[model samples]
Target: MSDIPLEHVHREPDSDTGNAVFVLHGRGADEQDLLPVADRLPGDRHIVSFRAPDRLRGGYTWYDLDLSGGGLESSQPDPDGFRRSLDMVAESIDAAVDAYDLDSDSLGLLGFSQGAITSLSLVLERPDTFAWVAAHHGYLAESHADRSPDGIEGKPVFVAAGAADQIIPASRSEAAAEGMREAGADVTFGTFEGGHGIGPDELEAVQAFVEEHD
Candidate 1:
């Protein structure tokens, strides 16, 4: 769209209900990376996936990871880059709302790894902006600490983690759930037996969650 600066690819719903599920890919991936994942989700809503602005390796990254000390497991998001990506994503969503005639109240989010962290940060500070969220193999970042669990009570959120994940440990995802639960979000935290990537079980569970809420 002319008003939207972010590069995105969308899949139209079979039947539009003015609803949408915005899918965010992990670092080193682009909008197209998550289209298959979105297709598997059960919803009669538009699917949108966006490319992160910063290019790295052979793909895109939402923010840089500072792995100087404890490495990827304990690394933190670069404040400046994270903030910029956040603002740009917000702008994209606003433009999408106007361009697609979407119902803002029916918007949901699905993300993986770095994308999950970004998604969680976005919704945590502004819970009312989205209806539900599903984060896979990702955790909550310490940078954006504006969590108001009370204001987000009864909100549905599904959190999936890999028991053997090395990149962003399962413990981090558990902690993310704890934080969201405090925020009064109806969280579904699931730990599958695997590594950093989403597995079949995780996909099935997430699909079920989206279906239940849809």
Candidate 2:
């Protein structure tokens, strides 16, 4: 994975509940970008904000999905490159879980845009690594089909999208939700009033979703 360590922001759960939230940042952003979302969520949840492995310009990226150009294939994943990056991100998650002594069954991933795409890839790659995944304004890269995790049946999932989002169109969002459903995730998809970003109301829904799943 480029032999570079992905930086991360961590927030211990306010209560000793042993639950945690892993936050994945969007393109051109670092771990700090999503830390505030963690804060806005339930305080009792331990939170992790992870930077992407590749540093393009001043921020980071999960894969090459050209967020800058908005073209069809600017930053699209080249199978090999994406595999390496995904492996490192998964390894980070494993280490984070072990370091915190957290239960994998109670773990969740929260990502936005590029982060969301990475989150979906992570869940698909591991099969049963997380209890829940919250993807905000993100979609799976092409050709990645959905499948059920071996052991974690009924795995919960939350997806949020902006109706006017020009970056990752609403159609892609629906496709993502459908794909997750086909893969057997207990999916909850919501659309907001804005575009390309998460709003306060969306965060509230995310908060409620996590609490309910936990």
Candidate 3:
């Protein structure tokens, strides 16, 4: 894993509750860019936002992939990069749990775009590490799908996507949802009327899921 430093933003909801939501930002964005989204969520829910590990030409990147080929193919997701990011995030979760004396069963993750892909991968890679994962407009890497047959049997998952999205097409998102379902995760998938970015309806759905799971 790359030894990268991270910037974090946190919000503690209740002094007695240990439940927390770990938020991951989208591409070309930092922790500060997405922390404001927390304002729309429950004020009482503990929120933690983490910046990406790598600084690209203009922004940040969690992993590397080729987009010049017209269609995303033969691209590599930096395992070391994701490893570092996961370590940082995992440490943050542990600290939150300890600081709040939280029940291990109440920890959740919220990720958007590239963040969503990372969040979903982390939960799958370490099946028992999290209670739930909220994936917003991201799909699983195709390479990861057939590598293992094991699914997150007990973990709850919420996936929100835009039907008109051209960047990551709705078909791709649906396919990921199907894969998760076949893998035994309790999945909740929703599609909105927009494209690429999350809209009000999607946010509302995410808020409800977080509240119910958290």
TM-score of each: 0.95, 0.88, 0.83
Prediction 2 TM-score vs. true: 0.88
The digit string of per-residue lDDT tens for model 1 on 22-125 reads 88899999999888788898868888788899898989999998776678898888889989988888889888878888899999989999899989888886
70-142 per-residue lDDT for model 2 (tens digits)? 5752335557667777787788888887777777777788899888888888887775778789999987676
lDDT scores for all predictions?
A: 0.86, 0.78, 0.73
- The candidate with the higher TM-score, 1 or 3, is 1
Looking at model 2, which ten-residue stretch has the lowest summed lDDT? 66-75
Top lDDT model: 1
**Best-to-worst ranking by TM-score:** 1, 2, 3
Q: Report residue 11 deviation for candidate 1 (angstroms).
A: 1.2
Please state the error at residue 134 of candidate 2 in Å.
Answer: 0.3
Pairs of residues clashing in candidate 2: 64-75, 65-75, 66-75
Candidate 1 Cα lDDT to native:
0.86
Q: Point out where model 1 deviates above 4 Å.
A: none
* Cα misplacement distance, residue 198 of candidate 2 (Å): 0.5
